[model samples]
Target: MQADITVDTKGMACPMPIVKAKKALDNLEPGQIMEVVSTDKGSVNDFQAWVKQTNHELVHYVEENGVFTFYVKKQ
Candidate 1:
């Protein structure tokens, strides 16, 4: 599998994380996955809600060593 991914968005705030994620997803073809990593806690909820609103798919997510990693597939 291949992903048009971006990662390690540390030191960013709420909307910036999601904004960058959206921007990356916008550049992908349908069914492509983008992996986003952020230090912001709110990104977990933000990405989930974004996927719901935009009809995209949240493929997977996890946190390790205080970093949040979210995998989203573009619709």
Candidate 2:
């Protein structure tokens, strides 16, 4: 999906991806979307849980070749 902003946490480990995502998400409008690209395997769980605790929408996610791409919509 298209995003208003994109943040790549490609070699980052735990917390960093979420950290960047949170910072990036802050720049987005309430209904805008942010795309996050992560190479950290644990980010899948982290993103899912993080979105659950936040006022954002997990639009969707995809995984390929150990890369995890997540789309989140600000709410």
Candidate 3:
């Protein structure tokens, strides 16, 4: 899926990925998509919980090699 913004947190650890994602998402308009690429394994659960708590939509996510990619739509 294409995104209005893409945040690459490839080498970041735990909270950093979520933190960067939050900042990127904040700059997007409602219904716009934000794509996050991270190497942090914790991002799986982190993004899930963050989306739930923020009422955003986790449009899709996939893992390739060791990188995780997520598409989130702002609500």
Candidate 4:
């Protein structure tokens, strides 16, 4: 349940969070976890859809206050 890499996109919206997550994920080896922190509510669906379209895995996600944290595992 630990991320190998973590990126904070707390102030970013939509594609920016995804963009940064993609870039950060690129640095990870297969099976590594990437944690993305964002404040954008829409990213809940964005990350879900993005993972489905790619070879990665959306391991888990959580919402704390107004912050959204996504745990994605690279494939």
**Number of clashing pairs, model 1?**
0
**Model 1 C-alpha lDDT per residue in residues 38-69, reported as the tens digit of each score:** 99987777778888999998888888987988
Ranking by lDDT, best first? Answer: 3, 2, 4, 1
TM-score (all chains, Cα) for each model? 0.88, 0.95, 0.96, 0.93
Residue pairs in clash, model 4: none
Measured on C-alpha atoms, candidate 1 has an lDDT of 0.83
lDDT (tens digit, per residue) of candidate 3 on 1-75: 878999999999989999999999999999999999999997789789999899999999999999999999999
Which residue runs does candidate 3 get wrong by more than 4 Å? none
Distance from true location, Cα of 9 in model 4, Å = 0.2
Q: Among all windows of ten consecutive residues in candidate 2, which has the lowest summed lDDT?
A: 41-50
Question: lDDT of each structure?
Answer: 0.83, 0.91, 0.93, 0.91
The local lDDT score (0 to 100) that residue 22 gets in candidate 3 is 95
List all candidate RMSDs to the true structure. 1.5, 0.7, 0.7, 0.9
Error at 22, model 2, angstroms: 0.3
Residue 31's C-alpha lDDT in candidate 3?
97
